[model samples]
Target: MIGDTPPEASPSPDASVSTGEKTGADVASAHKPSQPQSTESHAKHAGFWALALGSIGVVFGDIGTSPLYAFKEALHAAAGDGVTRPEILGVVSLALWAMILVVTVKYVGFIMRADNKGEGGVLSLMALAQQAIGKRTAVVFTLGIIGAALFYGDAVITPAMSVLSAVEGLRTIPALENSISNELVLMIAGVMLIGLFAFQSHGTAKVGLLFGPICAVWFASMAALGIGQFIANPQILASINPYYAVKFLSEHGMAGFIVLGAVFLTVTGAEALTADMGHFGRWPIQAAWLFFVLPCLTLNYLGQGALALTVLDASQAAGRPFEEMNWFFEMAPLALRLPLVLLAGMATVVASQAVITGAFSLTQQAIQLGLLPRLNVKRTSETQEGQIFVPQLNTMLLVGVLVVMVTFQTSSALAHAYGLAVTGTMVVTTMMAAIVMRQMWKWGWPRVLAFIVPFMILDLSFLSANMLRFFSGGWLPVLIGACLFTIMATWVRGSGILFEKSRRDSVLLTDLIDMLKARPPHRVPGTAIFLTSDSEVAPVALMHNLKHNKILHEKNIILTVDTRNIPRVHESERITIEKLDEDFKRVTVHYGFMESPNLPKAMGICRKQGLKFDIMATSFFLGRRSVVASATSGMPLWQDRLFIFLMRNATNPTEFFHIPPGRVVELGTQVSV
Candidate 1:
């Protein structure tokens, strides 16, 4: 079992875990990888509740904050002329049941069990599916890319939407409602979101402990709010029946379908459940959702519906218009409403933090798997394996979020775009997961069909419902995802072509060793390590050094760093050494996709095996390539240019690998891809 999961692959020397070959320098990252507990018994462990509490802060934060705008938006959408009692019941029922089926049944019950070696996430699922198939298929690879692209879309919108929705809750306070203008609210949310993003670099280890208790209060307050309304109307509990959801949908034709899109807001962050399973473990997340989170969310929605029902009846009697307010914020009493706003704001910030962290983790996984170019990855915490931050991603996400917030201007408008990426991601996850169930879990065809078909239908229905808003703002996620997918596809295609070109241009390591032995070059004193993707072929840097300098080091190492399909590699299995000749040795270092590739720390492990990797006495040789666009490249000319752009912007290997610059030498080469 590995530590944390995020994504995965590459080949030749790169082909071990998920995909095929990445360049040697791409192996480095900012910090040493931390050891993660592989024990799958978190539920039985002493840290069970602590893990569950952490899950509340980091995992469910996204979905937990949904109540702020979900019912308000759904009710408004379905309320063509006015909200009827039946519509209230229906919207509440739909929201409740969607969470039950999607989050509870699909994710908690089934998807969590499909984890790849104790890791979860769409990419991890892709790796697991590839493992089950005994080879990586185009279908699995495409699905993984689509899911990850959609996630990036989600990552951008979640922060904007959550914060905006929570800040809008200030309108519920009588004192602040009249004082705060819509523009003022946007500015406030903007500042808050910027602050949250700014805080990301500091690492959440210290304050992360507080997340559990805060969310616990948030959930408890939601439950209390619901129960308070239940005192006035106990019959609202009847919305729990599926009959209301089905009946409401059957009666309201187009409007009900449109409401389905808005109802999806309830489960928008459901992916976090599966994505973060590795952080808190499967059991704690499940237990938290099934027991505390589910009940609180269900009750809150019921309370909102009940309050709406009361308002409807009072309006009908008075002959006035039935107004639909932000019922989540209104559920609290007048004096406590401001405090509720403060609490909601805190919860929303926490939600945004979770999505941001997820993005960083996803970036790390994508880079390790060769799906994306290497970025400046920094470790935020020494203790936690999942606490790294990617500066490129952080900046991109912050910009995207601010732009989205400004463009949409309201949580209501942002809601239109929110569900599209999330639903598409769910659909892709559902497909990939079904395959894993059939092949890996060995589920019968009938069982698999029964398990997956309903989810597919539901997800597709949600996706189509969201399509109605495509012209409005729904196209935002679709556009963002498309751009990201193009970039990833281009990178993969470009890297593969470049690797092929290198393989053809390179000499065989075995033959080179034999030739050198027949007529050995002038030997230097210290050890020299040349990183390569293929151990069979001589590294470009090694060849360049020998040809240009006309000398060789006394001791040489052909270092091949592998990112395994799993999340974390055990230290015992981290480094493998094979003696190639008197002067040369082959060293292979293995890391999980979720881990940072700290070469020095990994190499230090070799001392246990009678091979000492002396950092002070070693020289690191890196092959730096200038990738120019070629018309004959496998990718189009435009794509070739895009790949070159990405490569040029990627983090330098000396910094990325945490190698000392003074001890490193880079050999330059040109390649067309």
Candidate 2:
């Protein structure tokens, strides 16, 4: 059985919310510091379905469907074209150990303990590294981002392989022998993938309800299947001995490395457990895994081996055990075989959903961090607070997945492309976990080294194993992910450089006010509030107001709104208004990243708090870098161009921020990073 799930930490910071912090000359200095609270306070609200279904539905996908091929491939690597009973048993034993050590022990038991504020994901970990390690944060941050990008590649492959393998069961079913073809099976998977995305806008609240029970039963059935087989061939139970696993490894020698790819699949969803920690809490997932999942997985893996021994005479069955095995299907009633296939297919769909959701969350964080251009984001379910759908991303992923499915066509072919992306992600997670253990958890050196050493050996083994497939097709996803990562890094760096360069020419508010006093004060009729991108740059519109109109408004408000990841803010944390004398106020609004900033709502909030915003006041601000460009300095040539391309297509913030279109004036500044 997969070992006990590792203990995990809970932190609540979804990357989807844009909460940029700014620094500079014209911008007001100082921000309300994020206060530390009991991490437990950020638990899931009323939408248990979102948590339950999403956690089970989205998070369990990759790992859940892993059993389809993990053992099969492992055996093939060990015994070549044919496997003996002993070899099959040994391979299953090795696979069980890999799952236990990598998934259950490393991730569920240990890595989960590193959540940031109840939100657990790569970026949240990166944020922790920033607070604890300072400049070194970027290194880990980059690695984590690369991991996240690689996840996108995994997402592309999971659905392709899982669905195909499940449909391949058609080859096993006697009735569909003539009707099913590889093209037909692939087309079915492609249609299912498309339909899956099409339904995303409607949200998963409805189908999600079925996911847990369905998957629970699916795991139970696999365990049942394995247990029944084991009862018949009890001798195979000896494979669970650690001696079998160690013996297989030492005896196999160099050949063992290739098995790492297959082994990696067993632990694919480890990160998801941590990523979904905010939804289900630490205990439920752990409980579900330890008591329910582990036993079932172990039982099923053993059963597969037990069944393999009956027909294939272990030595000749290594390359394709299922093709040689009669017991796996023959032992089951015909009526139940199709059900198992359906269950496997559904499990694969769930796995794909989890990766898709992760992608959405990651994209949101990239935008907020200025690493990515803004996109139109919609919350899919009212009840499921974290349920979100991105239309553009949805279409893009759908197309990418379809192209891959069509091109690869078979699960075995797609397998060549699978492990590299997930392995890279695993490596990145370990590196970040090491940072968290040392810095945030304040673990001693011995404890930190103990955790990372074994994990690194395992992770690198998979990475190296996957490298064998790079030229064969594995390079596709890595290349795609790396290119995508470069685009994000470039845009972020470019924007930062532009923001910095603008500060030199900007005037300070206090100094600007002094300059206004020396000139004749001709007043505009009403108050004017200027929106700014940076805390350091002065609003160019304010300067425009001075030079052209020769006057400042009767009341001027310098407003900076910061969106943070916490769900809700305390009343004391809402609006901080500092008087600057002569009807001028510097207003800073702190919004939970999950909450949208409504100008009208916020204006009313200010009204209730005694900060007067004259109804007639029109906001004037310089909106800098409305478009991102690839200046050679910040990002590479292609990335700068790509950033510009994405920026040009991005939705204008004017509509997104809920500002009055006509009343708000936009002053654009060109920026190249």
Give the number of the best model, judged by lDDT: 1
TM agreement with the true structure for every prediction: 0.93, 0.86
Candidate 1 is scored at a TM of: 0.93
Per residue, candidate 2 scores C-alpha lDDT tens digits across 301-400 of 8887877776564444465443543233444568788877778788878778777877777666555544566677778877766687878888888888
Q: Model 1 residue 460 lDDT?
A: 97
Q: Name the lDDT of candidate 1.
A: 0.85
Q: lDDT (0-100) at residue 456 of candidate 1?
A: 93
Question: What local lDDT score does residue 165 receive in model 1, on the 0 to 100 scale?
Answer: 91
Per-candidate Cα lDDT values, in order, are 0.85, 0.68
Q: At residue 298, give the lDDT of candidate 2.
A: 88
Alpha-carbon shift of residue 2 in model 1 (angstroms)? 23
TM-score result, candidate 2: 0.86
- Tens digits of per-residue lDDT, candidate 1, 610-654, equal 886567889999888887888864788999899889888888877
